[model samples]
Target: MQIQDLPYPDPGVPDARSGPRFLWWLFRNQLGGQVRSLAWGLVHFLSVSALPFCVGYAVQAVVDRSGTRLALAGGLLALACAGNAIGDTFLHRAAITNWITAAARVQQLLARKAATLGSALTRRVAAGEVVAVSTGDVEKIGWFVEAVSRFTAAALTILFVCVGLVVYQPSLGVVVAVGLPVLALAVLPLLPRATRRADFQREKAGRATELASDTVAGLRVLRGIGGEELFLDRYRSASQEVRHAAVRSARMWSLISAIQVLLPGLLLIAVVWHGVGLAREGRISVGELVTVYSSVMVMTYPLRHFEEIAMAYSFSRPSARRAARVLSLRRATSEDGSQAGTAPKGDLYDPATGLLAPTGRFTAVVCGDPDAAGRLAERLGGHPSSTEEEPSVLLGGVPLDELPLSAARTAVLVQDKDPVLLSGTLRELLDVPASGDVDAREALTAAQCEDVLAALVQGSLGAEDPLDARITERGRSLSGGQRQRLALARSLFTDPEVLVLDEPTSAVDSHTEARVAEGVRELRAGRTTVVFTSSPLLLDRADRVVLVHEGEVVAVGVHRDLVHKEPRYRAVVTRETEPEPEEPHDLQELEELEEIEETA
Candidate 1:
């Protein structure tokens, strides 16, 4: 898969059984790229290794004063140089292709997973951790995958060089072969410590990242409450912890690097010492001695691959583990293996709470606890609740879980209490993937969003339309009420069959709230609309009101009737007591003054 063809047609399900297995799966998927990289890498390293042999032959030709041999050696050197250049270029190309494709594959998997889990993803994984995995962690995994092929080529080149040396000169070849393995394995004992430090550093870094994200998201709130400095200090402490862990990790890796360098130098010295003795005993020629020395020096470059591979594995192990954790999460309904059947076409019902929103009617649900109300709204839209078994909500008479995900979402739309406004122009925000005929202007009017439109027009340049005005991320520039109204307008524009709103008017003033209630009632006259709120104005407008207490429906009736009949319902809708009337003396004095004025 090339980078241009990215966002692969089928990213395919990942083997998320474990970190190592996931890495292996990625490697297997990109086998073609990996093979190309390995092939080119071998060519490059082999050409590099053959250079010493060519140079060694040229030196012998010069010593023997043979022009023919000298010409042959020169030709061989040119061939080796040409091969090295071509191989190096292609190797680089193949390696980069592998890296980009692997990272793209991982990104696709993450995107698919995020879509499947939806909002539940944030509850299962931190927003910061998810960001980290999709961004930096994916690159690290790709780096490991790309490095594996190069490391394999390096090892193979080294082995081939050793075999060539043994055939040319057994005495020095044995010494070189034996010493290379020692150099490579010398740092194995330190890897465990290095890996532990890397894991700790990564953990601290993830926490710091999460803290920073949270701080930025709540910056306005922090400033309002005068808690910005506290959060800053907390982030500072977290960053310091990450720094210390990284330093400790670097120290261990540095020690391993030292061992790698020191051991190779020692091996080079041992090979030279043994080769000189063989030369003195007339067992090896000067050219042979130079070849052995150059080969050992060349081996140093390949030996570093050991350290590179080790470092890659150490960093990628935790990243792969994190990616696996996210991919392993499945929807609650899918986990239990029960097919609830397709979303039925009718009223929305939550069996768990015994609350029913009838078709073509406006229903208001009042709950004492806001959280319970939100969960109920979610359940009504077919979202699973953690506390419930067989967490399925029915649409018409069909269980929501039984329907296809797209069909279910299309049938019932749930607007959360704090709905997100994606960064876009007003027009784009309302351009949702809706199935029914919806007019954006009508929805905006119904949502009481005139003020929002005026604000947008005022913020824009001359002659620019308000609908074309750009909104900042999460609509942070807009007031809470404006954001809420805009969100409601967007939801309305979807024109879903069943619309569930949780405290849709909580952020607006009473006057605006009443207008929104009336508008919603008028616009959704023949559709199911469920509003989870205790606002008296909104409740009084609903055709039917249900009181949900402690997760069950405790009372059902008109808002005015319930207010007088149920104290619990009355207490929630009207928290304060009513004042008494004026005294009898005050009433008699006002009547006598009115009679006197009339006589005069």
Candidate 2:
């Protein structure tokens, strides 16, 4: 395939069981491209090999003093030169196409795998290792794939030349044939040592990269606590380790390179020495002697490809292994089987927690244990903990865990308690895979971010539009409340069939939280939403409230009724120290409610 047609429609599922299998899978999928490259490589190798024979023919013709022979040799030389040029051009073109397409395919697969794994990817795979695999290892893998075809052609050309030489002149031919194979195989003994050193270098580099990443990510915190120098010193030590390992690996590879040159030089000397002896005994002509000498030189060129392919394989094998490990990670509660495309249309229920959020209602959940709250919220969205054997969250009549990942995601979206905001423009941050029904401004308004856009614009780097303003990494430039609201806005933009939010407004002030609660109630009208919070502002807005204690649902009722009638629910929400609050305290609490403002 051409480079322009690349990044294939889908990178197809990878055979990620092992490194060798994954590498084989990549190469096999690109068989058509590889075959074409192999053909061009063959042309290049054969044409290059033909040049030596053509020169020898011309030499013999000149000695014979025959004009016709001289003219014929000249014509053949021109043809061989033309063939050589054409073959080299196409060989390089095809090889490059193979390399880029293979890498692009791998990139797509890794991206798909990452999307499937979500936040869990970093948990299972080191962040630095993932970065390293994506950035550097991908190219090395593609290089090996591209090298395989050329190496085959080189080996074939070597065999073909050896046979031709033997038929032309036996005594000299034997030496050339034996010496060429020796030159190719001589570096094999050193490869394992070189590869071990290379692997050590890669490991050191991955650790150093992880250290640097962690240092950068926590730089602000480190500076706050005055621990900057400590981290810097640690990273410095890691960088030194990486440098040392790289030097050791380079030393081993350098030895291999020296052997590549030394062996070929020795082979050339042996061929020439034998050819001269044969010529003296009248067993070979001057032209024949010249042919054997030149043939050895030609044969030595393709031998370099052998060493290159070996190095490529050594580098790429480990790369493929790492990529495979990442790709093989499966979500603990997700299924990859057939599923309906449409979202389930009914109540959301978590069987283990016995929490029921009825259809088309605003439900607020109060969990006495914060840990329990987090777990329930994630479980509601089908992201159950791997160690727990909880029953699947159900929707309509279907278990979400049994549904396809995309279908399950479409049915419900759970905004984590601590939502992360990646660095990007405000517009890009909100540019998520969504139902596309809710407008960004509408979601922003619903999340009570009416002032956030203005703030972004004021702090923007010359950008007049708030949506176009750049957000620093982790939204560090924005306040905690602003970040939380923006995250809530992003979730609202998706407009899913059911939305579960965990401590979504914990960072906002009481007044703003009240407005946000009302806004959410209005915006999510006629849709199901489960909000996990003990804040009366949000709970009072709920059409129904659920009280869970120690992971089990203990009570369910209207917020005001539950506060007055249910002691356990009241204690959890009010943080009660007495049997009940005083009359004035009750009055204050009632007035603060303002009763959720009837959804705007």
Candidate 3:
């Protein structure tokens, strides 16, 4: 599958409210399990509430001078504690299990969507954003999902306590009922700011992650150009920004936490003060007031949860939005075309440009702009380029866009100038998909990789089997020419009906590149191949060459013929030979051309 055909997402401006909506979607889908989790949580919470009741009972029993009743109350208290412990253990385990499984499922779905969207995914979203979603964001989403039942149980417990208090002691109960809402709702004003700060923190974190990834990826280039220190300084600056954002986020959460603690304490003081006045007036008994005090203290636990839920939601909402954005990307599929599994017989036709790459022929396309050639290669390989007009690229007579991805891939392949070589053995490096049972010997010979194999052999103890020798990541262990030949050999082994190579030997010397052109022709005989290159040797070898100037084909002929016939083609192929404004002598121009050609 080509990368450009991978699904791309069009995530509009992310709504702050999307987090709640996402949670609701998850909740609805897992309602049965959620209900069970909530039920267990409630049982556990109610069992806990028994502690306060037992204290209230024991106080009354002692006041009444009933030893037997006091003993029974203590026993009841022990039983309630045991039940709460058991229930809480199971409750936590069940809830956490649900959260993990749900998160895993969502991540899997996102990964599948990403694969379908292919290269388009990276085009729309930063690599770091995708990384964050899979790692950090997924876990945050899970926490929010599991927090649901716990939060619900806490809310219910609060409601139950308020009603019970009112029934037991009407005056104290009224204050307790009124104050609980104040504790729960007091943090509302700070929530918006906290969430905004959290979002900023997450965004900065993602950017830092992206910067780090980019820096690591180009570390070799950066070092070669003496720009490593410059990048390091930039990264340090980005880190400082992240640190500041985190501090702001932490401050907001801390303020919410302070209110969570202070407000409840203030409510407790108010309840105790009012309860004592009523007791002095003979409206309520001492034991009842003690019960009221115990209840208010217990109420602190649930109020603490209010603060916890707020903080968790604040952090997790942005994460969920990020994950949602990734998930929402649609895989690239043809909108209007036949879904035929069959491939066209010969040649590739770009209807938009009226260009044809004839079957079983070596066609050289010379674009005035290198970028234009790259775009054309991308389109020919059944993928979209960043061209303003969405044009159809046809393989044989059938539109490439119309064919199923598998068919399109089998029939056409585009080898980019710089292709990725994953870390593995030499054999694995040349083992292209669908090229089954192709020994390393045949492919190495075809791409003239004898030097590459010899290098692998001389480097290590396990030298007899060069294919088994380990390749460093990105083939950094090998020279540029060796890497290019290995990539070319891998592509040759695939033996696609139509092979499109974009400057396959751009990094190699003339000797190796000329050999590669010869090897490519010998190995891919009677197969349609289009090479986008300005190399004299490769162009000379083409059966028919097409020179594209300013996005249109201006001349069609062999390399020597075009060099003699087309001035633009000559200037491009021998760019280094062209007399510079500063040095216009023919002798100097010839010297420069010889030097450039000799270097190549």
Candidate 4:
């Protein structure tokens, strides 16, 4: 593939049976690039291999005192030099091109797999493993892919040289042929031990990486609990383990490298000694002796590629396996085993909890345990739990697992409590696959996030519009309230048929939360909306409130009636405070407060 065509439009479904199989699949896909690289490598290796012959010819021509033949040798030597330069240049060009394109392809596949798995990716694999596979593993895989063609060329070039030597003088040729194999095979016994050590090092490194990732992700929480020092100690221990393993791995590789150096030198010595014996016997000319020695020296260059290929495969094998494991994860499938149809529409029901939200109504779910609330919210989005055999949420009598991923996602949009905001401009952040019914302004206003837009405008460094203001990664630059509200706005803008929001207003102040609740109730009218919260303002605005204690529904009614009757529901929402006799604030009153806040 061309560099410009990189990031393939379709990275095609991968074969994930095993790491070696996956590597084979990647090789098959890039056969054209592999061919191009191989062809260039042949040109390069062949040209360099011809140099020893040129040198020998020149020596013999001078030894015979033939002026014409010496002149011809000079011309051939110059051509060989030019060929070497041209071939080496193009070979590198093709190898690097293959490397970049292969890396890009793997990256795209990982991205696609992550998107398909959604939040469950972290559940199945450690966050650090995913990070490592996407970053370091990609390059290793590309290294193996790029090395394949060059390795083949090197082997073929070695074979050509060995044959030429055997034909030039049978005695010297046999000695060189036998010696070259010994030199090449000498490191084989050491490879397995080196590879084992390397694997151990990689495992330790991965564990350290995982610990570091977990520490960073929860750094804020760790500091709050005064446990950063404890985590630091743990990470230091992990780092030390990694260091020891790495040292062991390096020692093995160093031994192998030493063997490689020593073997080549020994082979060169043998060739020189044998060539001199042949010259003394008058079985080979002085010129032939020079050619055989130069040829043996030249052989070292191609032999290096054998070690390179081994190293490349060693590093890439595990990386490819890790990537394959991730790609093999499949979402819960339907009972019928198909996912190519239209999205269903109806009451949102969770059979596992026996909780139901009627069609086109705003429903509030109050879970005493926050973790339970988050899990239920994820379930509403068709995410399968490790404990559950399949996703039990259904829409219009059809299980969500039965629907295509695109259809299910379009039908039910879930905004978790800790929603992430990728770095981008305001426009890009809000640019989701949204319904045309809700525009950016309407959604922003409904989410009570006008202040968020105002802050972005005030923070702009240039004459950029509010929509053009750039957001930092994960919205780190914004306050907790602003990030929450901005995410809420994006959800509202999506305008899905069914929306599940978990603690969407937890970060905002009571005043802002009250207005946001009213805005949500009004804008989501006649659409299925389920909010997992204990906030009184939001609960009161809901058309129906369900108290989910433990896992099952314990009580269900309007918020006003439920507060007076269901003590569990009242205690959860009101935090054990005596329920006020008065109903919630009216919509017009909240709107007036919104106007006053804007004026201030």
Model 3 quality (TM-score): 0.84
For candidate 2, the per-residue lDDT at 158 reads 95
Q: Compute the lDDT of residue 63 as modeled in candidate 2.
A: 94
Give the per-residue lDDT digits (tens) of candidate 3, residues 1-600. Answer: 112322323212222246677766766655666777788887788777768878988998999999998999999999988888887987887687667755765676677656555555676788778888898888888787778878898899899989998998999999999999888999999999999999999999989988988898778789899999999998999999999999999998999988888988898899889989999999988778888888888878767777777877888888888877776654344422235576677778776655678899999888868878887787788777433366677766687766777677778888877777889888777666644634556667878889888887777576578888777888887887888888888888877888899998888899888888888887777889999999998998898898877766778888888898889999899884656566546888889888999999
lDDT of 4 by residue, 1-600 (tens): 889887797887789899899888998999998998888888888888888888998999999998998899899989988988998998999999889988898999899888877887888899999998899889999999899999999988888778888997788888888888887888898888877887788788888888999898788789889999999999999999999998998888888888888888888888888788879988889888888888888888888988888888888888999889988887774322235678788999998788999999999999999988988888888987756764479999999887888888889999989888999899999888998899898999999878888888777688268889888888877888999999999999999999999999998999999999999999999999999999988988999999999889999998899899988887887788775776438998778878999999
Q: For model 2, where is the 10-residue window of minimal lDDT?
A: 333-342
Q: Which stretches of candidate 2 lie over 4 Å from their true place?
A: 332-339, 366-375, 385-387, 418-425, 433-437, 459-465, 468-476, 534-600
Error of 2 at 389 (Å): 2.9
**Against the hidden true structure, what lDDT does model 4 obtain?**
0.88
The sequence of per-residue lDDT tens digits that candidate 2 reaches over residues 414-470 is 888878899989999988888888899899999999788888888886988778988
- Which scores better on TM-score, 2 or 4? 4
Model 1: which ten-residue window has the lowest total lDDT?
333-342
lDDT (Cα, tens digit) per residue for candidate 1, span 220-318: 889999999999999999999999999999999999999988888888888888888888998888888888889988888888999999999999999
The per-model lDDT (C-alpha) reads 0.88, 0.88, 0.79, 0.88
lDDT of 2: 0.88
